[model samples]
Target: MEPVAENKRGLMPGGVAKRRFKLSAGDIIFSILNYIFFTLFTLICVFPFYYLFINTISDNELVRTGQIKWYPVGIHFNNYISLVNVNSLGTSVLVSVGRTILGTSFMVAASAFVGYLVTKKEMWGRRFIYRLFIVTMYFNAGLIPWYMNMSMLGLTNNFWGYVIPGIVAPFNIILVKTYIESIPSELEESAFIDGAGYLTIFTRIIWPLSKPILATIAIFGAVGHWNSFTDSMILMSGKPELYTLQYRLYIYLTSTSNLSALMNSGGSVNTSVLNSVLNARTVKLTVAMVTILPILLVYPFMQRYFIKGIMIGAVKG
Candidate 1:
């Protein structure tokens, strides 16, 4: 008998040809359907922002008439340009930037440190303290009492109000604590053997290792600070200089007279033409675009860490 012909495909242990895997018709159909579904989903999610954007750039006259859907018509940048003329716009932008940076930094550092501390077996009442932190996440004093607390603390109209009250974010601490627990205790033990103090080990070792979760916390804190106008509305009502970008934008969007005044403030632009070119519709859309741009720009940079941190941090908690 002729020797068995060697299989052209890879052989199994018994010298039988291995079956090649292939997608069935159902899989191909499912894949096509999946692609279609996600594509439609993506467009649905993205269309509002695109619509907002086109309206801001389109002819204000056409925008007001709702004729600028799907694509921009008679595109002009007058809406954005007119914002520069709004009083305190520049100051509000600075205040917003300042609060976001400082608030995020303080929140991240406080969360990291508190998270690390709670992981220590030596700390007395560590579990109690951590549980207390978690409790705040579920409970809140009414707005009236909260406002009273802020006023009593003299945080109202104070820049520190934005930073200080949010420093110890309970949810962030929980995430950080859970993430830190997943780290090898051997590392901390080794540091302890090397005459390293808790602070040194934390600052030198834990901090670096905790970047993923810290970044997640930072994004959360920054977005909270950037988007929060209610705090500004309540606390900084007396302090226009401390007004945030969101608060200023909120005021402009709600007040037609403010929009008109903003257009008129641009002396170089003829009032008659400017009024038609930069109306309430265009200004509202433009402010919405401006308010959203910073978070959009920043989110992509931290998304990888955010995903990884959330997944790992959430594993235990």
Candidate 2:
């Protein structure tokens, strides 16, 4: 006997047919254009790093003559060794690592605290305070005046220069403030009812919930501190020991046209290896990679938080 026809509709999960929306020709065209535009944009953004990476690893002759392209030509790792040969490499690394960790931590905490306080309607002169910070975003004192201020404050030649100046970033504060305002007011009210003080409510409830925004701002602070060269150049000019990695890298890049001269001039590692690979261009590319790798590595770990925080924090209170 022939089997009965199957009830295809009832057999499907949810027992309901999925509805499909037909797109207009215009919609399809718009989507296609959007994809094309973004693909090009992504390539534009990514190609520089790709070029830098390939050039750094490619043979010196290939990089100099513009022969290196999509892939590395003659694989060379000596550019990295040249970077390691610098005498102050260890010190610069320590300075950069220390400043990044300390500065980012302080900035995140202070900015969040200030942001939370500004969200409190009970606070007096809150509008004025907020406006004061916002105004700084648009205007700044000239370089001379700023340098003089740092000099007067004795921040010159000091490690605190890196950490202190960034502790209360106005933009990060605004981001946190907007995000905090988005949080339900009843949460704070309920905490108050349970006899939670402002500090307790902040540490226990606000801080925990504010992780996404904090991580985003922490990334900003870390990148800023890590890549900061001008600050060290200006503030620690007299103190070579206080020089950061970026500052040292800056000096290396600008100090000479000849890679061999620059490498042989100071640094403890006067190896034949560095001498063999003495391609200034590739060496600079290697240094660039070293400088950016930490931040790039960090992005993958914090990417989820960053995307979520930016989207949510952008919402108006």
Candidate 3:
């Protein structure tokens, strides 16, 4: 039997039956042992999430009374119910969604343009420019400088503060550049000879051909934006209305005496200390679900690109 390329119903190019990856007796035994170990590993990885799910929606009374330790003793909707009533939290979620979308779009566009430029042999100062961006990834400016810069830029208390800061990833630019380099240069040359400008070639040829890698970038940047809290925590001091969901949830969970005060911000009494713990748990779950859902949903579509991009990027200059 030939070792076949998946999705193509054919043998190896030479048509000789392809080499097979066969197992010896010891290999078979080890393979089985590895699978069993990995199965247990997988279960271990998922078990914590299962615990979180069950405990999050569990009755607080049951949890406090020690009737439930690892799983829900009684299911109740109040955990989610309490969360649904907070204006600041709701505002935060919307802001986070907006920030993720807005920041990702900006990142994609900027990275795309920069990546295209960096890939061109004709561009002067390309090496310098690429290095300039890449250096920041290794040595970041301190937090105080970043905060003061934001203040100087008047991004403080502004919704754009969170959305604008992270749009250009030097690493992402490199990834896109590498993937673009993998594309046959002849097509671009032909486009250039046919009177296509950089914008036209990029918009017409590169973008459509590069959707898979773009999707990969979108997933990366969007997850970063969605999970981000520290920047918003530092910068968005005055604007409760503009707080990202993660930051608001962090404060809600950590602020013990302020639960009632936070609850009152929305004119909702659903945040008493007893109920707030449950809310905190639900917030944890909600954040887990929300942060992951987009990546999970988009993953299937971009699987090929996700793999191909790495392969393409790995090729030496």
Q: What is the C-alpha lDDT of each candidate?
A: 0.88, 0.86, 0.77
- Displacement of the residue 140 alpha carbon in candidate 2, Å: 2.9
Q: Give one digit per residue, the lDDT tens place, for model 1 in 76-172.
A: 8988998887678789889989999999998999999999999999999999998898888889898999999999999998999888999999999
Candidate 2 lDDT over 1-317, as tens digits, reads 96544355634355555565999999999999999999999999999989899889888877877888899988978878877676777788899999999999989999999999999888999999999999999999989999999999999999899889888799999999999988898999999999999999999999999999999999989988999899998899988989998887777676445554655677554466554444545666788888899998999899999988888899974
Model 1 segments more than 4 A misplaced: 1-20, 257-278
* Residue 10 lDDT in candidate 2: 39
What lDDT score is found at residue 169 in candidate 3? 89
- Residue pairs in collision within model 1: none
Give a tens-digit lDDT track for model 3, residues 1-317: 96646435445565655456877999999989999999999999878767666765777666545566566777886656666776577788789889988999999998888998998878999899999998999997898998899999999999889877887888888888988888898999899999999999999999888776787787788879888998888888887788887786677667744654666677545436556565565556655555556666776777887776666766744
TM-score of each: 0.86, 0.83, 0.80
lDDT of 2 at 294: 95
